[model samples]
Target: MKLIEALPIVLSCQNLSKSFRGRHKQETVVLADINLEIRKGSFVTILGQSGGGKSTLLKLLGGFLPPSSGNVLFNGQSLKNNTPDIGMIFQDHNLYPWMTVEQNVGFGFRIKGEKPGNYKHLVHEILDTVGLSHARKLYPHQLSGGMRQRVAIARSIVVKPTVLLLDEPFSALDVQLRRRLQEFLLALWSEMNTTMILVTHNVEEAILLGQKLVVVGSNPGRIVEEMTISDIQYRDRYHPDFLHVQRYLESVLEGNLKEQGDNYYEEVLAISRIQKINS
Candidate 1:
């Protein structure tokens, strides 16, 4: 692992485990014996199959969900509950219907007893930064999907959260929009320097957005693979180096899912269409 110099470890988990009771006291484990560390200003992506406990792990790290065993530490302190220093963006933007763009973006500050006069400049600055200044007066219903998501990002980040946890924020958007938003997110990360951990099922998207990618396997979920891609050349989607990483991650996820069943063959077919196979 190529550790980023001068960056402090902002998040850490040790021997994490989460399970739930189902079917007459049958314990169904989601994640077990998991360990991970996220450094300040790092972009980490979590990839796995549908039932592979990807989002569950994110919740655990963020303290939105408690682990059945072990613990998660935020900046060397145990994370007991959701903290303002750690922000979260869900798949759904969840903007209030009546709230304007600026209102939604500054909502975090308002809830914390911060007057609008204090956060007014910051809200406008973030709105203009995300290219949503013109729509600041517009409500959630008035904005398009991409614009709404931008608002969501602005909302989570305006408060200057130490770390941001995103649960597949762009999964609902179409391909082109998703890429555009991905670029937008990268720009935000560059400017804000917030440590981000994103959970997604899209291998290509994961490869495009993350500095470090972690693959989680099902049946008592655990980290099966981890890769660090700091070289900018691999960011190009069409580059062989980029495709090689994508193919490798797809193969890992496919092999892990194949044991579950062949019913989920669409992923294999989609990957095969992009990658040539030796006959």
Candidate 2:
């Protein structure tokens, strides 16, 4: 999706870094000197290899974890820790099985001590946005995996946070379901105009869903490449540009792996040459 215009800034990060303790007590850096700026109402997807700092970065932004260095800012305010302005959705629904769908969606308000009568209307509205209105009374166990995920999404969005952090939230679904939910998410984002950052290893999804695509990898997870996803018309997945972006992203991801022996590097160079030729 090529952006026709520059969007307003909704979130920013500067010199963000994080590290974990290794088995030998060595400091294992997961993210290093990361910097990012997220436009309000934009969809930003982070594509990275497994064990990369993609998830860790998401957690840091969401305030689920503290960054080792640098700063995260939201709307000129320092994000020293978690703020209600940020909402998070994980791969696991994390829905309370005992709570009904409506109850789950309204849980955030409840935690803040708001009366049910005050937020009940909003809960229903957000549920409808995710196409879960009819399932409002259903428990988590009574819903399909996709439906459960929708509930999770509704719960996060009901409060209308400025930024939404998604950690491979759709990875558990079937391919078709994943695509459907992707479209749903874009639609919701359009309607709500919420800034969103998602972590995923899926190249196609990253290219198709993100206006700004970032490739991250570890040994201290840092952004290796950042590219604007232009030329996507969203008309069809089989479009030439779509396939081209996917191939490019796949090649980049393959290059980030630990097994990039000489043969692998040569293969990658060959693929790059071929893609350049085709382009």
Candidate 3:
């Protein structure tokens, strides 16, 4: 096996299942039988339709939510709760509005009661890497949407976590900005080499970022498909292979929507047919 393939598993989940209790003691199964293994320094992307439990699965993996059954393993040990070794970035950027960019990025150290002198250099290095050094004095409200998200990413990585979970961090941005941030994130991942898992509904984004792509089916979410992506062609959005993979994943997502009895599925199919014909 190749050296990268021989890398140690940083995170894995075995027979993982999660359910929520609703009104009248009813149960809603959000995820089921999720078994996954993520190698160190690898990037994995979970792609599914909205409300398909992609985010829920991410939370379970990060120990932000408890699994109703099975276990999430971190380095072969069962993870019972959130750990500093695991970091998370959400869609909202979740920065302290009152704190400046530098303060927010270094807040992890402050909360742990560490002296600034101990972590100041680390904070500055990460800030400069993310190209946010100039905005270090700016508050969350003072930065643009993409800039704010970068700050959140910087904060999560400043502590040098072994794993990072991103819950659609760029979903809120416009197309151009989202693409820019995606490239920035890819570069950052290359530099930091953190084991990263991102959950998103966007097929293109998933294909663009992940070393492996996992598709979750809805209505009691389960892992329907997993693809190991290594070809450089998959990274180029305009490439034929990339478009082919994108279309296939879209069909998988549409099938899930159809299974849910979603009425918009037919409309989407019709639109897709029209677009193909026009092209």
Q: Lowest summed-lDDT stretch of 10 residues in model 1?
A: 270-279
Cα lDDT of candidate 1 equals 0.86
Who is ahead in lDDT, 1 or 3? 1
lDDT of 3 at 242: 77
**In candidate 2, what are the lDDT values of residues 1-279, reduced to their tens digit?**
324136777778899999999899999888999998887778889998889888788888877888889988888677877888899997565999999999999999999999999999999888877888899889999999889888998899899998999988888889999999999998887677688898888888887788778888667778876766544343257986666557666777877434445575455446444433432
lDDT of 1 by residue, 1-279 (tens): 223434789999999999989989999999999999888998889999998898889889989999999999999999999999999987676998989999999999999999999999999999998899999999999999889989999999999999999988998899999988898888888877799899999999898888778999999899987666666655799987678678768878887546544644455344433332210
**1-279 in candidate 3: lDDT tens per residue?**
112355689999999999999988999999989999888988889998888898888888888899999999998999999998999997666899999999999999998999999999999998998888899899988998889999999999999899999999998899998988899888888887688899998999998998778899999999987777656776899997678667767878777545634454455445434432432
Q: What's the candidate order when arranged by decreasing lDDT?
A: 1, 3, 2
Clashing pairs in 1: none
Count: clashes, candidate 1: 0
Q: CA lDDT of each candidate?
A: 0.86, 0.80, 0.85
Question: Taking the candidates one at a time, how many backbone clashes does each contain?
Answer: 0, 2, 0
TM-score of 3: 0.88
CA deviation > 4 Å runs, candidate 3: 1-4, 256-279
Which should have the higher TM-score, number 1 or number 2? 1
> Candidate 2 clashing pairs?
29-220, 30-221
